[model samples]
Target: MSNNDIKFIHWFRSASPYIRVHKGKTFVIHMDDSVIGSDNFTGLVHDLALLNSLEIRLVLVFSTRHSIESRLNDHADVSHYHNGIRITDSETMEVIKDAAGKLRVEIEAALSVGLGNTPMLNAKVIISSGNYVRAKPMGVVDGVDYLYTGTVRSIETETINKQLDANEIVLIPPLGYSITGDVFNLQATALTRDVATKLGADKIIYLSSVDGISDQSGKLIKEMIVTEAEKYLLENKIPDAAEQQLLSHAVYACKKGIDRVHVINSSLDGGLIQELFSRDGVGTMISSTSFDELRQATVDDISGILELIVPLEKSGVLVERSREKLELEIENFTVMLRDDVIIGCGALYLYEKEMTAEVACLVIHGDYKNSGRGEQIYSVLEQRARENSIDSIFVLTTQAEHWFRELGFDEISVDELPVEKKELYNFKRNSKIFIKKLN
Candidate 1:
């Protein structure tokens, strides 16, 4: 009925795939005190409620770093850290317990809101929190006694899983207990990693102060595999301490068999939903495998390839290709896939006798055309041509002449076409011929 309505409909439709896949999958989310106290906290809670409604099992692990600092400062007590970990003495431990308890209650209250005419209306989200984590003290290291600072020794997975099975969100505070009736402070990042790994969660997400992981040039990296993330950490490429910590644990979680880890700015409203429900999320994702893949197409990809190109074909921007033809020529195609959907594709037809190749059916999905996906597909095709020892490559285009020209292709006469292609050329199309020579 309106532009906004249309956009909303499109977005909802686009998110349907993610929604389907995320259903019944467990996601472990880690948030620091910064997120709990942020202005968008309520909105984030609402999004999480929506996820629960969609049948996604949620495990929320929260830290109270800022809260503890505020309490310590109020009491005129100084905090200590060794190797970036807070050393919690008797007094600071009391502050941590107070902060964590208060914050957990605040989060629970926020999640329980369901006022009329509000986002949470009719959304009754149940939350569960308990001594689900068991801890062992870090003990003494390097001749320093680190009392009360601990690591996760084991998790009460059966109890947590029972809560999840009942469709309740499991809220884990950054505090663990020992067999001797002692409480210990735990790092939220490490807790998130251990929880997700132990529970075999589908994803581990960090809602943090920073936007996401970025390269040294300050460009946001949308996706990276475990190895690349480790390289970044090893070289100290990530500048933000928060992001560095998250990345370090993200690498660990992925290596430990968690399929995906996402880090997004908690201050950004609706970021949780966007990161979960969109094709290209608003944050960096670390996975054990590539999230988006560009590789040679197989016969199975003919359907996705045709879905991408049929619109162009109908618009007369390219010639029509039947499914039968696509199946036969699928081996000649390279496709760019996002979540296993072909978003961009091109085919290279080599004329080995003439030492040339034809780049054909270059198409990018309408949603991704502006994001340089076309160039990525073209680069792959060019590489393929070189690998095959082609002296030059060409394209016949009724449109996109300017694009080819920008890629260093010069206009050529149809008469210069390879003898075999010249005979098969469509004179009715009157397409321009562009060729790029490799030397």
Candidate 2:
């Protein structure tokens, strides 16, 4: 096979886990009017259709900001605002309604496209839109009458879920209806958050012009917890107004129990698929909790641990461990979990009488072996040893002796090992011993 074909097969296999994880889960995607005219908009639509084919329920909340601005400019009207929110007067509300309606139809058409040799060829997608969201006017604030600008009051979550249950992609425009027969302009960022929260969606994705959130150095921040997202917003670190608003709402969504919120550049081809399927996504991910957790392993983590170590055991790099043995020593194991997948693990077998512990089964998934994660796990085990009043730790390795030495362990003879460990050592393996003395 050609190199490209091999790469495709590898990527497809790698993405299988994510595919299984996302199936049947709800995701709310937000797109502004700006994306409609972008060169890669069709590519974005293709990715959406692909996701739909993967059995992921999708909800699209789209805004009309650019369209509204164009309409107002055409009519020689200027927009008014209060606290960064558009003040939708009678005329402005008319423009908003027209823009929102036009954009909704455009988006629906884009999603429905199917042609020969196109990604959406033979792809059938049903788009649903309605008065599933209710709103109330923002009313007067600081003695300024905000006529039609509004906030989401409630969402028809049950009805929306019913449509999703039927395998339809629910399309929501950035306009809400009121009880008094009124159409109100809504802020799309807050609207997306509210929709995801109400639906209990698994993810909220913002397709923006920016690639993702960045730090002061202009480096793209791959991930952040909710608190970190809030801090970035509070510090006014995000220079783009659109990104700032998305981050603010992302924090709100996380606080409301949504697990993950992604912000990716809409112009990038296949960006949605790349962000959702890849292990290291190409965009920013703000999560409710730490995405990578280092902690003591429980019995529940046995299967993941086995998936990591079983290959190494076959290669003779590490000793083989039985399921029952791991379960009995589960408390002694510390694992590095990324999105709940164990990527690295190590075990500390304590010997109280010897005032030392044996660090064993040090293994890292091959994909992440060079990322310094192994060192982090080893450090945690060393700290664990210190906490238990152990003066030193030892590791026996047939292949990783140099790695242990770099961590400050010195080469040691097997006779230097504790009596019990020496007695249990496998003569056939003949692994080198290394010990680190904790200060």
Candidate 3:
């Protein structure tokens, strides 16, 4: 087979797990009006159609900021705002309705394409849109009347759910209707977060201009949980109000019961699919448990610990360890868990008199081995050793010598081990010893 063909097979296999996991899951995607105007918008539509074909329930929430602003620029009146919210007067409300309606139709046409020139070839996507969201007036916040600007009051989930179950993509505009028969302009981010929360969606994805939140050094902050995200805003001043607002909504969503929120650069080709299918996604992921912890193992984790290591033991990569021995030495182990499931683990066996520790059993789950979980487990054990006043860390391995060497470990003689450990070393296994000196 050709090399390119082989690579395709490998990538397809790698993507299979994500496809299985995401099928039948509900995801709310927020698209900025800026993205709609980009050259890559057609590609984004194709990707969304692929998601539809894969049986993913989709709720598309679209923002009209750029669209409405473009329309307002044609008239003589300047746009007015209070606290970053557009003050939608009678004329501005007319512009809002026209722009929203125009974008909705264009999007629907894009989703309905089946001319065989695109990925939608012969596939039909049914989409629904309407008054599924109700709103109430902002009631003059800070004494500035938000005339036609409103906040979400209640979501009509049953109707949306019914449409979703019927395999129809639900399209939501950034507007809501009230009981008094008036259309109100809505903040797209707030509407998206609220709808996802009310529907108990599995994810909220924002297709944005920026890749994601970045640190002062311009490195992408790939993952942040609710608490950490809140701290970042306080510690680092984000000069861009748009980015700050987007991240604020992400944190709010995580706190309000949504576990996953993704912000990706929609301008990148296939970015939406890349974020969903890849192990290390192409954008920022604000999760509820981004730093899901490493804690000292307890008696309860014995079974999970064994489950993680037994395969390695069977493959002769690790020396056999027994349940009784593990139970007795459980205090030396630390486990990494995500959503309460053990994903990685390592142990720190301290040599008190020698002021050293042996880092052992750094096992990560089979599917997640290369995603830095093992490295994280190793770091946690190293910190544990330092806290215990150990000046060096060591490991004995039959299969992971190169892996350790890459992480700053140096091959060392077995005789260089702490006296007690040297005496108990299993000579028959002929394991290699590697050591790292702590600073």
Q: What is the C-alpha lDDT of each candidate?
A: 0.89, 0.89, 0.87
Task: Give the winner by TM-score: 2 or 3.
Answer: 2
How much does candidate 1 score in TM-score?
0.75
lDDT of 3 by residue, 1-439 (tens): 9999999987996576578668899999999888774799889999999999999999999999888887788786688987688898988989999989989998999888897878899779999999999998877887889899999999999999999999899999999999999888999988999999999998999998788878777788888887888988887655567667878899888988888999898889999998998767898889977656778899988877887788899999887899999999999899987535566788989998988899988898786778788888888888888888889999999889899999999999989999998998998999999999998
Most TM-score-accurate candidate: 2
For candidate 2, the TM-score is 0.83
Please give, for residues 273-296, the per-residue lDDT of candidate 1 as tens digits: 999888778999998887668999
TM-score versus the correct structure, for each prediction: 0.75, 0.83, 0.73
The clash count for each model shown is: 0, 0, 0
How much is the lDDT of residue 437 in candidate 2? Answer: 93
